[model samples]
Target: MEDPVNAMLCHHGFHPSMLAWCSMHQLNLGIMQDFSGSAILLLVRISFFGNYNAEDHLRESMKECTRRFKDFCKLHSFECSQCWLTTGMLHDNQTGWPSLKLKAYNARIFLMFVRAALQAAKSAREAQGLEEDAELSYAVMAAKALCSWFALVERAGRYLTPEQAAEQETAGLVFLRCYTFLARLAASQSIRRWHVITKFHGFRHILQSARLTLYNSRFLHTYVDEDFVGVWIRLSRRVAHALFEFRVLCRFLLRLQAMRTVDQRSVPARWS
Candidate 1:
């Protein structure tokens, strides 16, 4: 079975079609019986399929799948309320269900982030001749999405024992990638809003939190490749440079203000 699956994946060039087929097969076989488990698998399929192809059609498909999955979960909750054994109870008997749920939640949040990013890019393009407020609104939306993602990651961390989580290098790498993504987004936003003092503070906070996430997962260095580490290093440098420039600007402003005050003090009394 593994050979056939691998062969099919290779034959299909690891395309969305292969993922769709596997998803449908799982559904038909009742392998993913629980709504939450099924939803998680669906999210994974969509993520894997859409990752390499970021077309509008792919985005729309992902959105539709997510909407349907959410509806399914809602309906499942209502049905479970009438049943003796709830989905929560069922999951309690399954040792790895919590981890699966967390991964699904992360995937859902990432989908939201992708949608927000697309919206922001579209707004930026359309706002070329529009008011700055329009662009700012999109920026705020993106920032809120990032905040939600960070919160979800924190929440997911609480689901597992610290020792068990530390052993999950793959999951740690996922978290690292997410942190890097958030850091890059914040750095870009900071560069655009350099004059906004509050944004620089936010950027610093994002960088610090990302660094902490990576530091906690530093043990993953042996598992990941050099390129992965290099990417983190490059992103860190970019963020650091942005922070450095922001600080320099602040100092320049302070110096200019001081010089203006000195010039005012040195001026002769008003010609009365």
Candidate 2:
């Protein structure tokens, strides 16, 4: 990908990858202006709410951050920003899926990437069990994403009525099952159950494509002009390895959830 950060460093006469990671670091002044303007507008709309102001500010800032990310993608021609936005919206269902669904192609593609990254992260985590591989960063980020995942699912569920959620229990279970399977797979075990997720037919393909795209984006050459091939390759491998480790950790979380269910059933002392 030409390491855009490195390119910027060369322009600034600084060492490779040494620049600060400010939101404005890679953007042109125009993008920054647009971001700040939108941010102020968003904040202004919510200024009356004292306590909720911080939450609104956080939401607005995240949207602005996404906008800045979009600008970066446009400049770099990577189109990765779309995937990020979709995934972000999915992780923050409060954003409402309507806007994202309007760009369904992009949303689907983004989900593919998320699934792939999640799969790889789960795999690595299972394999290494958090010993900190070179790819620990990828796994760590994926785990972080899951922290968001719970919030997203809870919010998304709110959009549906109780009956709907009950009816869709199978669907939710399917998603969780696939998540578990991937986690277990990362731990070097064969996946024994696929019926839940496989019923949709193309879902697995979507996941595979996402994984391949992620793998290529991280590991393969993005340009013929760059000479840091060896270093980039090493970086990509580390990302993949870390992602695997993270996924396994997520599996542990699922197990913990299951344990909680058992414990709740066993303990009755609080009320008594």
Candidate 3:
């Protein structure tokens, strides 16, 4: 409704939309934290290694996967990170959303890959003279759902057309479906440690509210606020604590005032 914030909620807005700025970012952060202990990425990890919950095999698999990725990049001349997806994906990591993003990303087969695979599957089916949809592991679907979420956030805007809104809703449902899948899997596996947080459920509300409204939750993202807070933290550390809050406030305000006074005439003075 009004300047929809992260996860999007306003005083005038009813339920479903979460509190702006605080909730959605926290949801991402919260998911990141929980992922370290949960089965959220189990299927993706298993793709890297055949083992489940095998912490010992994680590094070996990561390095092996990274090596393969590097080789693939070199052979194809496609760009890739130096370390690939192995950095934050290690066991005992407190990785952020970026790392989790990497896991989700692995599921999004490139168009070329998808085409080739589909062609192969189609050939196999035709050869067999059967008409059944290609069977895929649930992991593939779940992982694709996460990728849809990433796509959703990347395309976030202040407003959306009806079609774009439908797309948004689709992405959100895909993501939520993955959550549901994981919840069910965890229950079946008796993974007692896994507990979904409120922010997780808040995402559904966010999507529902958005469908009713037109606010894009990712446009005015809260990450910049988080970064600004980091700057204040570094500045605060340099300031004497004698009048800590006051001193920090004055310094920040003065800096803002000085910048506000700068214009075209101030450029020469600035460089001079």
Q: Write the per-residue lDDT of candidate 3 for residues 1-272, one digit (tens) a residue.
A: 67647543444666753445443354455543344334323423434334535565665555555565556557767654345445454334442232234322232322122223334434555678777432223324534554566567566555555676677778767756655665676678764423466666666766665566655666544655565687688779999989999999988777657655323322223234
Ranking by TM-score: 3, 2, 1
lDDT of each: 0.36, 0.34, 0.51
TM-score, candidate number 2: 0.22
Compared with the true structure, what per-residue lDDT tens digits does model 2 show for residues 113-175?
333433454465567665643222332343334334323333432133344333334333344
lDDT comparing candidate 3 with the true structure? 0.51
| Candidate 1 lDDT by residue in tens digits, 1-272 | 45345555556346652221121122111111222232223333334224534445444544554554455547545221121212242232434331112232333333343344445444654567554433333333434444443343344321333443343433333433443443355367652121112223333333343333422222221223443466455544654465776765565556446645322222223311
Task: Count clashes in each candidate, considering only residues at least 3 apart in sequence or on different chains.
Answer: 0, 14, 2
Pick by TM-score: 1 or 2, better one: 2
Query: Model 2, which residues run further than 4 Å from truth?
Result: 1-53, 78-102, 108-178, 181-202, 205-272
Tell me the TM-score of each prediction against the true structure: 0.19, 0.22, 0.52
Using lDDT as the measure, the top candidate is 3
lDDT for model 2: 0.34
Residue 28's lDDT in candidate 1: 14
